[model samples]
Target: MYCRNCGNEVSEKAIMCVACGTPPLAGNRYCPNCKAETSPDAGICIRCGVGLINTSNHSEFDWLTTLLLCLFLGTFGIHRFYTKSIGIGIVQLLTLGGCGLWTLIDFIMIVVGNFRDGNGKVVVNKQRA
Candidate 1:
């Protein structure tokens, strides 16, 4: 993978670019897959056609409902179910949310607005329609 901000080569599991101090996939200035320059508003890499996934994008799930479910029934993976993550929800249920560790991590992620839904879109705080 490459840093989208600086086009610098980075490890696949890298959290941020060592050279630019930016999250690997957090920028649209370059393609993380191909290291090619890209427009900020471009959806995909014109060269490699790789989709530039952005965390700022919204999901269909509502933030308030998801937070409420996780707070109330997180151990049961109710939040996962509400987010349409059926497979992980089952796993979470069977494992009691990884013996609570997974649930705790998920709670933190959700509270920080960093949790992604089943479709990979960030579950952001937004007003209901």
Candidate 2:
């Protein structure tokens, strides 16, 4: 494999690139299959026809933390605030979580991994990269 950030050769199992000091798949500058320079917006490598990994969509929010916040502070929209959804957070806060119904629904969504961040990406269960 190759480092997507630096186009350097790397082990497939390697978590971080030695040359770039970033996760091997954490970038879009190069194709991991052929080490060819890739356009930032390209979804697939023109040279290798491999699907490009989209690191940007990776969630920055922790699932467990969001779940806890939803369970305890959801009435105040703390989880939405943590996920950077300030507009919704404010609305939720002002409405008191839609009279608590919205808060309950959000808590269920978090528990079932259906909640998303401000970017519309699913909240990740793992630690941030």
Give the number of the best model, judged by lDDT. 2
Q: What residue runs in model 1 are displaced by over 4 Å at the alpha carbon?
A: 1-56, 127-129
TM-scores for all predictions: 0.56, 0.76
Considering summed lDDT, which 10 consecutive residues are worst modelled in model 2? 120-129
Clashes of each: 0, 0
Model 2 per-residue lDDT tens digits across residues 68-118: 998899999999999998999999999999989999998888777678888
**Model 1 lDDT at residue 76:** 91
TM-score of 2: 0.76
Residue range 8-62, candidate 1, lDDT tens digits: 9999999988999987877668888888899976888899999885643556788
